[model samples]
Target chain A: MTVSIVVVSHSENIADGAAELAAQMAPDVLVLTAGGTADGRIGTSLEKVLAALDHAAGGDGTVILTDLGSAVMTAESALEFAEDPAGVLLADAPLVEGLVAASVAAQGGADVQAVKRAAEAVRGPSQNSGPPPQREVSEGSVTGQGPDFTGDFELINQAGMHARPAAKIAGGLSALDAEVTVNGVDGASMTALMTLAAGKGSVLHVEARGVDAERAVNYVGGLVQAGFGEP
Target chain B: MVLDVNWAVKWLTLCAQAMAEHRVELIELDRAIGDSDHGENMDRGFQAVLDKLAEAPPATPGAALKLAAMTLMSKVGGAAGPLYGTAFLRAAGTMGDAAEIDPAGWAAAVSAARDGIVARGKAEPGDKTMVDAWAPAADAAKAAADTGGPEVLSVLVAAAEAAEAGAVATDPLVARKGRASYLGERSAGHRDPGAASSALILRAAVGAAA
Candidate 1:
């Protein structure tokens, strides 16, 4: 279980969403996204960013990808901040591109350098490659009825439950006339839990209720695994 | 009373020696969560500073501080580099022109150093890092300055004690921010590297004054 932390000025969704789109087939590796404007909780704290890099290493070396200047400065600081400066690698490759590539390469059991190449491959030519992102799920679709509502699905999005996703998740629940409570979380607040740290690979419960419960559970569970980005 | 020429040399030597020792410890603690270069980087950076400050015709205390800041920034890498660099720069800014600093001037320099850290770090007390030690130590230095004591060492002792206490207080904290916070549960076991180095810096500062 190796993890890499990628940061961009734009929403992390594009990369994670891209990964989720690709995962329609891959389905094995988990790429975690945290910190960005898309997630309001994110800020340019070199110290905080370094913490994420150290965590990802898991004893093996961890590769870090950051967007532009301050992000680069923050990244450089992380290189200096780690216990074995050699253990934390600051990628010369683009963040989203690198992450998109690493997501697949890592799953294929490629070496760290292979993952780095994957990242470089995805670096959208001169950036500005796609539209910001369309909605992931609509309300009518989320509330589609089938069976009894039993479980909950969590938003494992890195930026926390910020406006877009929260609204998508909440509106779906609202249309269903279901009694939904976001648990193991601050209940639709900005501090949506991203780490999933029951020590990673652990089960976390996000509660939703009423008529739409069944679909919400499956969708949210799927979303958490997809790293919560639009397909 | 007053520091003799030997006393001045002792202060400079003490600051460099303590920084070298603390930088290594800082790296060990940082290994739990951070990049772990605080010790090697600062030690390397400050040694460069000492080389420059040994300039011919030597400088006044304020000029010496400014030279130190420039050397650290140019030589060191990481958050500590810029922040410490700014601290000495600010301390020099506050020094004006003085052959020797009285207790009040020392307090002013400490305050300037604190301001530099706050500005560079943008961190509050609970961030589980350097600010925790720096903020209280600055307060203690200011309070001691008001004592009107004949010995400047009184202010030095007061500030150093406060920083040391602040560093110890970090032991049980679940760090909410900074590199250590990524450890989550793992970060809890060690003392904060930043706080420890901060205490050492203050101890060195006081030792120089004493």
Candidate 2:
């Protein structure tokens, strides 16, 4: 079973909307919402958060994403009061993007820690701008310490490295044993991959290591070649 | 006299009374620098605590505090909910299963509660938040408890008085945290609503002991 997700927000609509948006990308993942007071006011409630945590418990694990200050405090208070805080984690990231990333990771069967990482990764370098993350290997013999496997694929789809494409690549890579980097960014990180902004016809330099190295390369190659089933 | 479960219950009951008595004043203070919900939230939270206490009265002081912590966290519906909840929860942890609290226990409990507030709110003494009141109160309680022939009542009074003074001291300071901080220099000359509520709560502890 995949890890469950809880969205905490001061506005009920915000929590429900964020959960709804995430569920679209991760149909099988459990994304619960704990927003607003029990009286339906605009504030976080510890009881509601506790109830959501209780529901999310006993799954593979649970990752919580919160919006604003009091929501974070309420989530922390719930964690403190929880019967077992072992598998529960609170991600310090923007609520909507973090929830979507976490939900996608969970749907791909990532562990709780990985799910938290995915959520937090949303806050990394802006996806569509900025210089790529510095790679340990230099350009030439970058292959000397090179990835176990490498492949170059052209983006076939009209809309290139957008959120959906990035999510697909990231979701698939997270389940693999390989550590992959796409065009200098962490391959399993959706936001990082989207940062590549490799639009249509752009060549994506894919590299991978670990036991699933070849499979990871083939996975990205297949997705890119297929245009991620998009136009 | 020993501060026992009965004392805890009475303290909470008096807290509810204090909240009711000072609700409008807190609301006015918050209106100057916050969302104006402090009094309403505190009153609602303590009333819920009273209801919970009636539903299942606790046998130990710690148990009573834990109950209060949960209720306030659940019902207060604001930052104060978790802030005060953590404070009470940590204090309860210090009390453990003991039926009564001595001067030292009171000192420890107050300090733990203050630390919990700091951890949860990430506020410092001069932040013009509730920490302004709690920090001095904790120090004063500890100092009173440290003196030879320390009396529990003396420790409680010291905390209450120090907290009251701390609350008063916030009136001229610029807020560095919470909603009041948003106002920048304008926040000065207004008493921090949280500090005021905290002072009231601490004063109620003295009333309960008396």
Candidate 3:
């Protein structure tokens, strides 16, 4: 079963709208909302959050994304009182962006931990200054340290490296056990990929290292070569 | 006097009365630095607690506190909901299923409640938040209980007085946490609504004990 997502926000409209937007990118993923108090006021409710956690318990796992301060506290309180807290995780990421990234990863069949990583990876350059350090290959390598797999592919679609294509590449790669980078930004991050702004005919430099490194490179190559199945 | 379920019920009822009595004053205090909903939220939350207590009369002091915790977290539509909810819940955890709480036990519960608020809110004593009141109140309760006396009323009175003084001490400090922090220098010269409400809650405990 796919991992479910819960959105916690002080404003009911914000939670509902964020879930709605994430649902568009990952239609198969279940995104629930627990926002506002029971009396329809503008604040989080532990009961509402606990109810959402209970509803999401049937899935493989649940990831919680919250907005503002008290929302996070309410989510934490719900987890403390949850029947199965082990299956629920809280992502310390922005609500909208993190929710979308998490939904996309869940749609790609990522497990609970991977889905959380997908959401947290959305942190902008300000939070994460640079690309992750390249992993050193243990096996006999001519170079002292290098990526296990590397590839370069040109963007062919008219839209180039847009939201959908980036989401596809990032979403698919997040499920893989690999550290990947396209150009200079994190490949598993949708927001990072979008920042590249690589237009049609621009080449994407890919580097990967891990058990699924080769598979990650090929996955990106396949998506780019086929124009992400878009015009 | 034994701190039991009856005392807990009386404490919460007095808390509701206090909130209602000082609602407008709390709103004014919050308006100076915060979102101005502290009074309304606390009033609504305690009223809900009162209703829950009526519907299901708790068997023990801990049970009553647990009921109040859940109700506050559900009905209070603000940061205070989670903050006070966590405090009460943690305090209840310390009480366990015991029918009566000794002076030392009550003091430990107060300390646990304060710790919970600090952990949940991540605020320090001088942050101009509820911790300002709770921290000193907890300390006073522990000190009073440490005297090895069976006088529970003395411990409650000490905690309540310390909380009241701590809340007043927040008047001139610049807020370092919560919505008031956004105001920067403008937040000074104003009492923190959270601290005020915290004092009121502690004072109600003393009133119940009396």
RMSD of each: 15.0, 3.9, 2.5
Models ranked on lDDT: 3, 2, 1
TM-score of 1: 0.49
TM-score of candidate 2 restricted to chain B?
0.99
Per-residue C-alpha lDDT of model 3 across residues A1-231, encoded as one tens digit per residue = 799999999999999999999989999998999988887888888889988888899889999999998898888888878999999999989899999999989988888988887788888656744574454554644342778899999999999988899889888988887788999788988888999999999999999877788999999999999999889
- Index of the highest-lDDT prediction: 3
Model 2 C-alpha RMSD to native: 3.9
Q: Model 2, A68: alpha-carbon shift in Å?
A: 1.4
| Candidate 2 wrong stretches, greater than 4 Å | A125-144, B148-150
What TM-score does candidate 3 get on C-alpha atoms? 0.95
lDDT of 1 by residue, A7-105 (tens): 432234443565464354235554444343222322234434555665566644455666543355445544544676665555566554455445444
Ranking by DockQ: 3, 2, 1
Local distance difference test, candidate 3: 0.91
iRMS per model in Å: 10.0, 0.7, 0.8
What DockQ results do all the predictions give, each relative to the true complex? 0.02, 0.79, 0.81
Clashing residue pairs, candidate 3?
none
- Tell me which of candidates 1 and 2 scores higher on lDDT: 2
DockQ, structure candidate 3: 0.81
